[model samples]
Each structure stands twice: as structure tokens, then as C-alpha cells.
Target chain A: MSGLRRGSVCLGLCLVAALTANAQTDAPSRRSGYHDMGKPLQAMQDDDMANPGMLWVGEGANLWNQRFAAADKSCADCHGAVQSMSGVAARYPAFTAGSDQPVTLEQRINLCRTQNQRADRLADGSRELMALTAVVAHQSRNQPIAPPDDPRLRPFIAAGEALYRLRQGQLNLSCAQCHDDNAGRKLAGVTIPQAHPTGYPIYRLEWQSLGSLKRRLRNCLVGMRAEPYAPDAPEYVQLELFLMDRARGLKLETPGVRP
Target chain B: MGNAVHAEDGLRPYRIVGDAIPAPLTGEAGDPERGRAIVANRRVGMCLRCHSGPFPQERFQGTLAPPLTGAGSRWTEKQLRLRIVDAAQLNRDTIMPPYYRTDGLERVAKGFAGKPILSAEQIEDVVAFLATLKDQ
Candidate 1:
């Protein structure tokens, strides 16, 4: 286990170095959203009591163990304690069998509820989905994010990367302009941290709600003066895969707080 | 502010009003005061989100693009009007959102369909405010 971790760590460091290597020599080491936040927001994320996202995390804990009569099952029934699910969410957006489609952690959770538990699929941003996904994600709170490198993901990864760099919308901005080239810089007094998908199902004060990564992407599209995609669009999945791949070594901060 | 402009009530197409560089977007004169409010507002104009300028009192001013501090001195009112209406017409690589243009945009949220982010009057208003910032 330690050896595998070391290898992934090496890959993670290589990725980081490559990013900087591509930039001017004067640039400082990249920083996370956590590093760019003010003291108050940081403290808020640290204290579970003050963290509004914890409310959703708690809800997820209940849903895990709660039995659904319709499905004649509960997540805990098949998976046992939620604790065992640790480090599981960190390895998601996995290239699955059959079509080899990459499934996000949220999609995987929904798959289990519908297929194994015979329960209705949860809607995106539904409190139940947020709670369950958040709960499952919380288990891997500090685990390093590492999507598998199956050869199958290569095409999708390339497609996702293309989308990241592709300019779209009336504003003609791509994800790279703000996150890759100008990350850690101030934009409207807000630090545009590298577009890392570390903390998700995150609590955003702006939304005054916990939302998925897809929600943030939609918001970015809107900010770009482009129309936002519908919930869980294939384009979003492609983008999510790229974001997670870019964020390979960052520790999961699910239920993270953002201003 | 003449005749109350009364522009934001609905959607309409915009045409350049004069032959000059600093032409009015429409026959109506823009109220610089109203324009200032819209530019500072995050939801409405949100200029400061990606622009830094002479507004020292504002907080969280981003430094993503060229500041608007000397915009009036650099570009004529007509030029500013056109840029605000659709910056893509100027620089295809520009990240500035077109405040008034409504064509060729993909996947706009249902609420904003067929509607520009800022109304035509609001675009003029932003141009008005931007025109007040002389280089000095």
C-alpha cells in the first residue's frame, strides 16, 4: 500500500512540476483554494459546528443506514458501515465496465441506490443526493484524489482536456484563462484558485447551499456569458474527469466551505 | 436620464446610432450615475469582477484585464459603447462578456434566453460611466 502511494505521489509531483515548468521561472508554487481563503472562512471549514456543509454530511450518514422498503435495502445493507467506504470516493470518475464510461462518485452512488437497492435515482442537488454523496465523500475527506489510469480513460481524458482549453460563449473564455494561467490571482477581489475539484458537494456562501461540482461548472459557464448545461450533461462529465485528473494529488475536502 | 429611457422592461435589438467613433447606442442619452451603479453591481454589470479601475472605494477589485481607470482617454464614448455591446467584435480572445449582444451564444440559462445580460440602456449607462474616467 505504501509503495503504491509513493508511486502515485511521484506522479502527482511530476504533474505539479510540469505545470510550473510550462510557466515563467518567477512564479511561486501553486496554492489551493484553502491557501487563498481568508482566516474566517478557513476557521469555518475547520470547525464542523460552524461548517454549514456538515449539515448535509450528517444527512448522508443517516441515508446510508436508512432502509428503503421499495428497494428492500439500504446502502449500509450492501456496503456495511459507511466507514469502510473511506478512500472509496477518492478513486471515482472510474472507467467502468461495458461502455467504459467514466462514472463520477455521485453517479456511482446513484447507480447503487437504483440497481442494488431498487430505489429511485436521486436528483442532482437534491438534499438526499447531497447528503448521501457528501456522507460517502466525507469518509475520504483527507484521502488523496487518484482516479485510475486505465488505458480506457485516455480518449475521454483528451476530450476533457480539449474542452478545458476550448474557448466558448460570448465572452470567449476557456477554463485555462482563469484557472491555469491566472490562478491564485485576484479577480473581483476573489482569488481565482486553480480550478481544482478537491472540495465538492461544497458549501458555497454565494449559493447559501451545498452543491455538486457540476453546479460550480454551470456557474462558470454562466459567468462566461454562455448558457449553463443541464444537470449532469455529458460535457460536464468530460470536464469533471479533466478537473479530477488535474487535481490528482490534492486531498479531498468534501463538504468544504467557500465564500 | 432624459425621458426616463425606460429600457430594461423587455428585449430588443441594438443598432449603432451615429457614424462617429463615440456614437450613442440609441437616441437616448445615458445617465452616467445609473451607469456607475450598474458597473459596480455584481449581478447587473459586474465590470469590476474582471476589471480594475479608478474606483478606489470598491472591494475585491480583480486584476484580470486592463483597468478602466483611463478608459475615456483611451477610447471614445462610441468606441466604449461598441465594446460594451459586444467586445468579441474587438478582440476574439477577450474574456469580457458582451453586455448587449444576444446572438451566437450557446446554452444560455432559460431565464436569460433571448435576453442580453445587460439591456441596451444599461450598456449605454456603463459606457457613460466608463467615459468619465479620464487618464489624469
Candidate 2:
């Protein structure tokens, strides 16, 4: 009985070794940490119910409450109240009935600037612009990030995912590496947040101001050693669309503060 | 061939000049005096922060970068100029703040737009000063 048991144990070890070798040889794509642990946005939005990042929302609110330029048109003046602004954010990355292209909330705000407020355009990712963006995004707290139901959004989403996977820059690291493969690991000094879109309008202590998802994406590109895309560039829009898809179902936390 | 006398009788004292060497640059525009003024001025090129130079009695220098005292001897004039023009252009991994107008700088005074912090003449002057550091 002892001899039979020993033989069975040896057979089990041999089987495990063969399976490991087979798995290694058959593996098709070796994706990095960023894209591997898929749908972190959904998890952060759905499962991580804690609102630890709410303080940035308050700061964004304060920025919104403040007057802008010489126009004295605070976001509060037009929107009237923030509670009324809720649920408007999740509908973004939406197809514009006019342009027939997808536009993020930041672009929409710039549109409001050009058409409604008659104000000078805010430089993309500028502090004043991001502050207002954060304030607006903050209004959408607790709402689900629903996929853009329009068929027009399909091409844009595909474009975005393609951009996400494309390699760029001297380091040759992709967004998928850190955010997907090593999402929670320590690189350099800081903890790599799951690259979920949950924290937007986040007050990064380094930035000393609130910023939008696009601004964060630009920063990520810089971190990846790639030259930054212009704020209104189509590549950024495509990447944003892909990021939103990855973050599908995650709750929007505009104006979130992060280390 | 012990300094072989040529077959021609009374061969004129053969001037045996060795391998041709490039002559050092020289001109009135190459002024180390101006370079001295720049090195001492706090409002201008503040290279002293990251580097130590021949500047006397300056105790407030930060040591983030190496000393530049013997830089002329260590690097060629062209190499030193590139270092001053844009450290990033030379090495992507360098942490040294780029003094040259490579990119991304904005909000400059109107007259200084598209110009490096230090002018090319100023760079030439600095290079002249650095070139004096060669050992005897």
C-alpha cells in the first residue's frame, strides 16, 4: 500500500510539470499588468463602495462656487444647483446629434464656453479648466457609467481600444503594463492605482489642482515616455473612449483627490 | 630609419611636423570675461545650484549634479555646448534641468520668446572659460 501511494504521488508531480510546460508554450499574448486584470473601473465603481475620495468633490464644488474671469459667470450661475446636474455626466462620451461624433464632458464644457458663456476658451488641462471640469464631474457621483447605447459609438470605442494597445515612446511601455498587469504593485514610490476612471477632477497633490480624465491620460502618456497628445486631439478622444469602455459600470468620481 | 637623411645632398633641414592637429578656436567674440559675469550673476544662468565651479566663496550650491571645475578638459567644446544647449537632447534619462530651449517652456517675457535662457554667444563664452581648465 505504501509503494502504491508513492508511485501515485510521483505521477501527480509529472502531470503538473507537463501542464506547466504546455501552458507556457501555448500562451498567445503576454499582456502587461495594465490590461490584464480587466475592468478595474467596473470593480472600483461597483464593488468598492467606500467614498474615500469624496473630499476632492468638495474642493471641486468650492472651485465651481467661485467666480470666473471678469464675466462673473460661476458654474453655479448657469447650472443653478448641482443636484440638478446629477446624472448628466454618465451620459457623456456620448454621440452628439449635431456633430455625429463622440465628445467627452470636457469637450462639452469647452463647447459651452464657445457657444453659451461667450468666454475665452480655457487652455486644455489648464488649472481653471480642470477645476470647472471637476466641479461638473462631481455632480455625477453615485451614478453608473453606462455604455453609450448609440451605434455611432461603436467605431469610436474600437478606435479607443486600438489606441490603448498601441505602443509608443522611448520606454516602449504600454498603458496596459502598470494599470493592467501590475495594477496594485509599487513602482518607484507610489502605489499604482488601478487606472480606473473613477477618480477624475482628482486633486493630485503634485498637480496642486483638480484635473479631468483626459488630463490624467496625458500624464499617463508622459509617464510612459510618449509625447503628449493635444487636449482636443482625436487620438485622445479614441483613448478616452477605450478607457471608458474598460471603466464601464464603474461609478464616476469626478474631482477625486489622489496622492 | 634614424631620422634618415634624404638621398638628395644637403637636404634642407626636414621640418618633421607630426600628425596634423586642429587648432583651438580663437577670436574676440570668445570672451571668458563675459562668462565670468554670467557665472556670478544669480539672475542669469544659475548653474551653480547643481554644479560647483571656480566661483570663489560660494557656499550655497546644491550638490545634485557634478562639479564643473574641470569640465573643459573632460569634454570637447562641441560636447560642452550641447550640454548647455539641452541636457535632455543628449540623454533622455537625464534629470538635469534643460537650460536650452528644447520645448514646453511658456509664459516667457515677450522679447525672449523662442530664445534659450542663455544666448549662443554666452554659451561660447562659457565654453572658452571651460577650455582653460586643461592641465599644464
For all predicted structures, in order, the TM-scores are 0.78, 0.49
Which residue ranges in model 2 land beyond 4 Å of their true spot? A1-79, B1-136
What is candidate 2's TM-score for chain B alone? 0.66
Top DockQ: which candidate number? 1
Candidate number with greatest lDDT: 1
Q: On a 0 to 100 scale, what is the lDDT of residue B41 in model 2?
A: 61
B1-136 per-residue lDDT for model 1 (tens digits): 1111213335454444342224465667788999999988877887888888777789779888789899999988877876777676666766777677666666555666667778767877888888899988
lDDT of 1 by residue, A77-148 (tens): 878999998997787788655435888888888888777788898988789998988988999998888888
Q: What are the runs in model 1 whose C-alpha is more than 4 Å off?
A: A1-28, A97-100, B1-31, B55-57, B78-82, B110-125
Error of 2 at B89 (Å): 28
Q: DockQ (Cα-based) per candidate? A: 0.41, 0.04
